[model samples]
Target: KEPGSGFWLKWLGAPSCQRGSYAFYKSVSSRAQPDGPVQVWRLGEFYFIRCGPQDPVCIAEVTLLWEDQTQRHLLASTRLYFLPEDTPKGRTREHGEDEVLAVSRKMVVRVEDLVRWSCGQPAGWSSSLKLNGLRKPPQSSDSNDKNTTTNTTDKNGPVERQGVKVLSYPQYCRFRSLQRRLQDGARGPGLQDPHLLALGAVRALPNTRVMYCRDTFNHPTLESNTNFSWQFSEYLWSSQQISFRPSACIPFPLFV
Candidate 1:
């Protein structure tokens, strides 16, 4: 792999994994784990993929983790699970926000699209450990220890923990699987440890607004952030989806 080997160029363009032309990885560190205990994605595990700059994230099962040869980029091939809202019937209180409907739709996305679980998710995604059986990070520590701090570093500098920006629709992101119907699709607590909720408190960022409105004609429509300024005039609301995304049952408040 030398300069002008066409890695970055192909990567920037977002090339898909070419058939018979990639290398495999046993696991991949999450591209967007906010704090640190570290989220490592492995095969046969569930995770989320970013769809667009502002669109809601989608949860999928990792089938393969590979590097696209031509682009020299790491990529993930996942089988997506849809929301009941994504179905024709829509959502219900019976279903936990973190639960997802199983489906066979698969897609290839840049590993950068893979994000970790969020704060305050249902118990199914976490076990007694909260890390869901994943291995602990190197030199990781409980934030309770105020006098001691440790971090592994390389030649360039100290390895700082990276955080991802919050999205408006966390409902679409994944955590646990939808179980038997008798349980009302409720998911039990799995295992999770967000770096001690990721070494400290979750970041406090202002949440964007997503409004589902009715025009003078009384037709339902959605008015979201500036980036959402699409031609929504003729758009029709789905009976299955909510007025706006649930977003953790949290209000879309403009104040604190």
Candidate 2:
């Protein structure tokens, strides 16, 4: 929460993801204390933040600290702008509305990490999906083993890997949909809301932050089948299997 703000901030992190604890700092640098005496609370995989009256109006930094004392890293160093009042004059959307990523993105797990987490569970489709891209090809395993040993030395010391794993477009969408449905439960009909889950991951290549299964292309196949029929053409087709046959010979009278 920002200082003098009427509403609290919610962190929308991924479900079932356990990465690390996070804290928000008001100062630009880590050495300075946090603004407004921020308090962090964890419930399951989600974390919530609250600040006292003394907090700063704009937060400058956010830090992610591992449970182990040996590791503490800065997740993001960005300015979080906030509105001074609860009400908006013209636009209802506040400035700091998109800050949900400060937490939820952490739930994205690696293939190896997912395997470790799902160990001992009954083998099925979910297990197979988790191992989709991660399974090493038998032919490449020998060469990969040798290369792994040779590349073990890190010139800059061992660093924790970050960023999302690469997957084909279709595979990524399917994996995201399944992960979200499993985490947030099926919504509406059969897991209709693909984006219902609050989880998200950083995408490769372009390196954009994307919600799992968020098909921005707006393709027909990716859309959910809603029960409600609003279009007149849809009603005619579904109920009568007949479309309006426009007769060029038929004349219509219009009042001027």
Candidate 3:
């Protein structure tokens, strides 16, 4: 039997094959049930067998018998997991859990986190394909308004911000000052001091004065004042911290 010859029918008592060429054979478990010989054959990746009335052979029925056995074997060996038949109508479970992982309210998961988690799986393994179209963050309305209102009627057009533009002396001076300040912090801001919070221009919250004094200075004055120490610790720890790196280019734009 040449490979890719399609079907092998030697077991049908065809003269083309020698006696022992067929790998599968017919057999009965008991003698009480007298039945005709069952035809058996192995073709490519599958094994097939068929048995029925011996006279006026029905080839269609024999083919169907082989198909039924193949289907039965396939279904028995395969494992399929489906949502529980009794799950409540509105309920859902999260993926990969016996019960779906569901949220009653709207939820957002970060793209970076999701990519890191599913880097190697097939497309179907994803939670939903609808969310795959990359969406950009909405541009700030204020910024859009500023661009739209820029005067474009005059030949000079008030020296439009885009394309070649002229800068006033004060604007040039301010730019120079900002350039100098950025140069001074080339390694980026450290995590300590009034300099630390002020360099980043972080907005201060209530009780920040006391908390900043305690944590930034580690003042000895708090030692004699036991009552303030506990409260100071709590306040200091509760503050949200931001860590940023100075970049030659805007990093977030590159990702989008």
Candidate number of the best TM-score: 1
CA lDDT scores, all candidates in order: 0.34, 0.23, 0.20
What is candidate 1's lDDT per residue for 1-256, written digit by digit as tens?
1242222211222222233554455455432223334345555444444444443344455665557566655655555554556544566776554344543323445565344222222232222112221123223255222111112234454343221221122321221111121135232244233422332222211121111111112111113433223212211121112224344432221110
Off by over 4 Å in 3: 1-141, 145-162, 186-256
lDDT of 2 by residue, 32-123 (tens): 12332222221111111112233222211222111211233222211121222311222234422212112111121111111112111122
Superposed on all Cα atoms, model 2 deviates from the true structure by an RMSD in Å of: 24.3
TM-score of 3: 0.14
TM-score of 1: 0.35
Q: Which prediction has more favorable lDDT, 1 or 2?
A: 1
Q: Candidate 1: what lDDT?
A: 0.34
List, residue by residue over 1-256, the lDDT tens digit for candidate 3. Answer: 1123222222232222112221111210111112422222111111111111221110010001011122111000100111222123422342222222111211111111111121111233223211101111112335212112121223332322111111223443443354355456542435333443233322211111100000011222323345334333432231111002123211211100
Candidate 3 — number of clashing residue pairs?
4
Model 2: which residue pairs collide?
13-104, 36-54, 36-55
